[model samples]
Each structure stands twice: as C-alpha cells, then as structure tokens.
Target: MSAAGGGSAGSIRIDRLLVYLRFARTRSAALALIDTHALRRNRKHVLRASEQVRIGDVLTIALGSGVRVVELLALPPRRGSPAEAASHYREVDSDGLDRKGQMTIGASSPAPGILSGDPEDFS
Candidate 1:
C-alpha cells in the first residue's frame, strides 16, 4: 500500500516477501526464483508470484544445493538489514534433509555428535 511496505499484517505478495527477506537481490530475481517451481508453501507448489503469505505460514524454498524451511514470524515493513530480515521468520528443521539433502536424522546429526548445542556459544 504505502511506500514503506504493505499495509496491515494479513498477507504480503510472495515476490515482495522474497525481496523483503533478502532472498533475492531484487523483485525480478525473486520472480525468477518463483518461476523455478521449487518454492512450496505448506508443502504445496507455488504456482504464482502474487501468492499471499501470512504469519505462521511454512515455506520450503530450494536454494542452490539444499532446501530451507522457514516459518513466517512476521511480515517485514521494508528491506532492512540482514538481522532485521532474519527477525521476520524462523528457520525450522524440515523433514530431516541433511546438507546434501539426504535423510540422516535418525542415524546422526548433520556434523555428527555436534547437534542441539552450539560449541562456540559462550553466552
């Protein structure tokens, strides 16, 4: 609606969300990613760039080598810093796809025994 961002919090256009979240450099780039047909909303294929995404909606996006599942925590008001964009959503564990997009959760962690807790975290 306004220049700042879309008004209200009901929904945001898919292409705009990708741009606001820094998933793509620009709106066109975001559209390209959508055209790949690898974007899934709640496990369903995203067929349009104008799809509206609201809070708590789960998205499975196929990145370069792996898939990333992010839950919409909030809609960003603008394309701010990386930290600001990160705050708008939460990265959640998907259906157990490892670094190479293989199932390995039951057997071991992604790095083997280094899961759950952070090693360099001293806080």
Candidate 2:
C-alpha cells in the first residue's frame, strides 16, 4: 500500500520525518551532514532540522560516493520503532536502501559489557 516517487498529495508532520530519518540511520548522521549543507529537498537546501516534509517530496542526501534521492510516501503522526517507521515510506529506485535487508541481519548485538563466562568464575 505504498508508492515511491508518486503518492497521494498530503502533508506529513516534522516529528514523523525525524523518526523516518532515524530509522534510515540517516537523521543523526544527516543532521551532522546537514550542518555542512549536504542535504536538499526538491533541489533546495534544507537547513532546518524541524522542517515539515510532505508526500511526494524528493529528498537528496549526500552519500559517501554519490547522492541519494528518496521520495516521501506516507506520513504518520508519531515516531515508532524502526519496524514501524519503515512502513511509512517506500524507497525510490535509489541505492540508499540497497543494503537495507543486509543491515537487519547483523543489526543488534549483546550489550557491550555483558559476559557469558562461567558464573563461578566471577567469585
């Protein structure tokens, strides 16, 4: 129930975009990049982190070797978990999401300080 580069015209709140950007692992990093003027919406530089984004809006972000363009799809009211945020938009024909599936495979790990050694060894 989503389309990329094409969607029913609608307005999406700024908070939702923050969640989506976080989900994409691009918000925090994008925020830093944006500070350097590396992000654009519809060809216009986006300087504010709280700006609202609407459906069908094209977002161009600078990647390591190239730029990525994403078309906003649906908009939700509040930010959700990574899984929920992903449901809000469909990635356009861009390399930005090409490694998405690969990323989920090794996404999480045990806490850094957690140990599985013998309990008696602690004594």
Candidate 3:
C-alpha cells in the first residue's frame, strides 16, 4: 500500500501524491515529470520524486506549455472518482497563492486553454 502523508506532519511524497491525485496516469509518469526538473514546490524547483509535500505546500508541474499549480491537501485513501480526487486540493496561481480558489484544478479542462470555474472530469 502507498503511504499517506507519511513524512513531516502528514506529508505525502511528490510522485505518490501525483498518482493519488490522478495528475499522472501512473507513478512512473509522475517520476518522469520530476526527472525533467520541471516540477516546483512553492515556486522553487523540485529535485526529486521522493520529495515530501505538506498540506499547504504549493506545487507547480509543467504540462505542455502551461503549468499546473496544486496545493497539497489531505492524504487520500484511494484514486476515487475524478470529483473525489479534486477535493483533495485547490489550484494555486503564479503569485504563489490561490485567488479564493478561482483557478481550475483537474486533469482536464472543459475548454482548450481557459479553465472553467468548477473543475470537471472530461474523461
């Protein structure tokens, strides 16, 4: 079983969190992203997949040309429905903070480039 918030005050490892949050299709894909050195924690570059993330730590992962910023949230027990997974965290902005949770937080958005107000599962 995967460890849920195992380190430093209920923290989860970056790669595992990605899988749990369904950000990647699998943990290996998550690790691949980390290896690119395109991942950031609180606007700082993340060096490894094993790095731990706390409940409020903001993460930035490069996706295509854009980036996805997600705040670490409570540890999830499983990869539930897309909606269930989304509840685990909110999206952070370039300013390193969420603007009242206005940004989209999901695997896919309804539109091509813009994010919908409410996060939805297109899959």
Kindly list the per-residue Cα lDDT of model 3 for residues 1-123, writing each as its tens digit.
235745565677888887777766677777766766656787666778888787788777666556677776777766777778889988766685555734443233222322222345225
| Tens digit per residue, CA lDDT, model 2, 1-123 | 222211334554332364444422334544555555655666677777666578678666554434446676766645466556557666567454444332111112222221112233122
Q: List the residue pairs that clash in candidate 1.
A: none
* TM-score per candidate, chains pooled: 0.70, 0.50, 0.69
The TM-score, computed over Cα atoms with residue i paired to residue i, of candidate 2 is 0.50
Clashing pairs in 3: none
Alpha-carbon lDDT, every model: 0.66, 0.49, 0.66
> Which runs in model 3 stand beyond 4 Å of their true positions?
1-9, 94-122
Supply candidate 1's per-residue lDDT for 106: 20
Which candidate do you rate higher for lDDT, 2 or 3?
3
